[model samples]
Target: MTRSEATASTTGTPEADEYDVIVIGAGPVGENVAERAHANGLSAVVVETELVGGECSYWACMPSKALLRPMAALADARRVEGASQAVRGSLDADAVLARRTAFTSDWQDGGQVDWLDSVAVDLRRGRARLDGPRRVKIEAPDGSTHTLTARHAVAVCTGSRAALPDLPGIEEARPWTSREATASKEVPGRLAVVGGGVVGAEMAVAWRALGAEVTMLVRGERLLPRMEPFAGELVAEALTEAGAEVRTGVSVESLRRPSTDRPVTLALSDGGQLEADEVLFATGRRPRTEDLGLETVGCEPGSWLTVDDTCRVKDVHGGWLYAVGDANGRALLTHQGKYQARIAGAAIGARAAGVPLLETDRWGAHAATADHEAVPQVVFTDPEAASVGLTAEDAERRGLRVRAVDLEMGEVAGAALYADGYRGRARMVVDLDREVLVGVTFVGPGVSELLHSATVAVAGEVPVERLWHAVPSYPTISEVWLRLLETYRG
Candidate 1:
């Protein structure tokens, strides 16, 4: 059925209300689950206490991108002075924070209610914990308590939270997490990011743009170790050029206060310490499965709830009870979680309808889909890194016969206009036997917009020859696609 037709219709009086599905979270992934379930003729209810858009809408991606966009535009303004006046170099910090507050609707959460109304899905304002299989207990804001038993299935899409590593004096200090970083209206004078991962780098650039001195400390030798070495190199370059210092190959030995008026100091193993106005722990995130009633449902005790190909939170007995999104500890990104939620939602709906349940597979739309294929990741810094598919090392590890090509991106016409002396990198990994684009990476200013072409080609398994026919628009940053393809021929 078309999405429009899935808008729920009134079926009964207020006294008699029941649903086919009770989704435990109203995050983006959970919202999608409700829509997909409703589309399959199963009544659904989404329970959430926080803003309905969850962490992504309120904190993570939306606000981060909002901040990063101006950084990119400012870089553009420096070149074209006429437009610079219109573009404005000085980001009214207060104005931008006002805009961010407006984006979250001033924390009023009315926008999310409108979305649920538009889709005709029911929303419950409360925190949900599992009571049993297919049972949920909700604790509401007004000190009211309620319980629900689903007629069909219970799907958990509760996302993750920032994990504070076992660092000495970390919790006592209460260093800024993503919550504080995203919500803070005032930029710290000196900021030290504890992890060199995606969150650390993104925040490092963002704070730097706001006129804050920033430093990034990474345990790994390079940034974005999940990506190819070349992509990591370009990100390191951009961070350094942005007036932030990047220190790699050093573990933070300890963190504590250097003085009463001073910021927290990170003592390094190399006998050096850097003082910062605030320390942000972006080391990683752990699944928020605590008090989730996984034990009542016969799942494991750890934060992670293991799910199979179809995203069923397979119990300790290796049976079916699925967890999707960050709760599953697989992919933490908002989009990927929504992608997996769709599969879990569909599988549950179809199975109960007495139809054959579809098994999840690499290319199958019913699976987590990105599990076996290109999972696109973009860090929305000024000089962004958008990467998908396998790396050269990943290709070789899988024992695939692969040929790799790397090209400096400034050679392209797109890069010339992107920045005066554009210093981006584009690399492609080709599966020799398959003759298809197995992987793609693009790093530089104005490159995030160029990522989808590569994602489409890689996920569609389009051959390099067919990709040649898929011409990128002229004078756009995407022409780097064509440039990299030409280098493959050379």
Candidate 2:
């Protein structure tokens, strides 16, 4: 059926209404789950307390990318001599912020609500919790409570929240989390970022370009440590060149603020004091499973839920409770969460209809097999870092017979012409026994788009010999694939 046909028609009393499927958390993941369940001829309803699109639509991905894109564009222009000559002055912070506001629709959920209505999935604007098996209780905005029942399944898609480190006075310091960092209207004169992961790295690059003296304190040895060593090396070089002071092996001993208007004082592990107009903690994320009433079903609260290939919560009788997205902790990425939602919805439909699952093998419609075998990510910094599947370190740790091939992206003609003195690197981890690419990493300007190609290779498990026939266009950065295959052959 068409999406518009799915808009819920009427509202009945909560006590009288029962659906085939009930989804918690109206984020992208939950929306997809409801749509998929509806497609399988099951009635569905979605519950959300925040905006329908969740963190990604209002705060995380959309606003963060909107804030970073202008800085990246300016940097790209300044790299070429011809373009560099015409470019002048720092970015207009007000304009960039205005664009971000527009991208977020001024924190409104009208568009998302309309989309849900178009899809025919019922939307309940409230916070929801599991009351018991297939039963949910929602606390509405007006202080009224309503209960919902699911005839077939109840899916949890609450996603996750930014985790802050424990420190004295951290609560009183009024430090910025990712929500504040991405949505702030004004850029601080001096910004200090904690942690060296994707959010920290991208915000440093963005704020530094917007005229903030950014100081990035990483507790680890380098930035992007989860990727190849060279990825962090290239990103650090670029961030330093862009005027961000990146400190590695650093720790925050204490945090203090005399007044809300005053700068934050940070005591370092090395017995030094640092101060900044604003401090951001991009440390990590914790699943949003707490207080979801998991304890009602003999599961632990405030802990990640475990699920099977079909996303059914393990050890639960009858296989009716399902968890997807960050709540499951299989893969934290939004796209991967959506993939799990699709598989879970199909499994629910099959069971409801008493139709046995046709296939549970790899890449099956009822299994989230890709979460383990292939997961792609892109860090949208000035020099973008993109990768898919296993890294060389991961392959080695897993005892796989693998070889890592590295290439300087400056060797590619398109990269050379893309910027003057372009600097970047590419690496491919090849499985010796299978003769197929197990992983790929690209670090350079304009490398974000190259990630999908690598994802296809790893996900498809296409043999290296067969990859030769799929030639990349000449004078393109993608030619690095040919170079990588050639190096592997030798």
Q: Give the winner by TM-score.
A: 2
Candidate 1 stretches with Cα past 4 Å from truth are 1-18, 80-89, 258-262, 316-320
Return the lDDT, model 2, position 147.
83
Q: Go through the candidates in order and give each one's C-alpha lDDT.
A: 0.79, 0.89
Model 1 C-alpha lDDT per residue in residues 1-490, reported as the tens digit of each score:
3221232224213322356777878889889888888778787788886878888988898887777776777777765546656774466777767777777676666777778767767877778887876778888888887776677777788888898878787755668998888788898899989888888888888888888899888889998888888767777787798788999988787888745566787888789988889989898998877767777877755578767777876653323356778888877889888888788778878866877754655666567767667788998876789988899999999999999888888898877876777788888999999899889888887778778888888989998888888787888877877888888888
How far does residue 46 in candidate 1 sit from its true spot (Å)?
1.3
Candidate 2 residue runs with Cα over 4 Å from true position: 1-16
Pairs of residues clashing in candidate 1: 312-322, 313-321, 313-322, 313-323
Model 1 worst lDDT run, 10 consecutive residues: 3-12
Clash number for every model? 4, 2
Please provide, for model 2 over 1-490, each residue's C-alpha lDDT reduced to its tens digit, 9 standing for 90 to 100: 3332232324323444588899999898999998899888888899898898998899888999999999889989999999999998989999999999999999998888888887778888778989989899989888888788889999999999999999997998898989999999998999999999999998998888888999999999999988899988889999998889999999898899999899999998878888999999999999998888888888899888899999999998878999999999988888899989899989999999999988678888788888987899899998999999999999999999999999999998889999889999999999999999889999999999999999999999999999999999988999999999888888
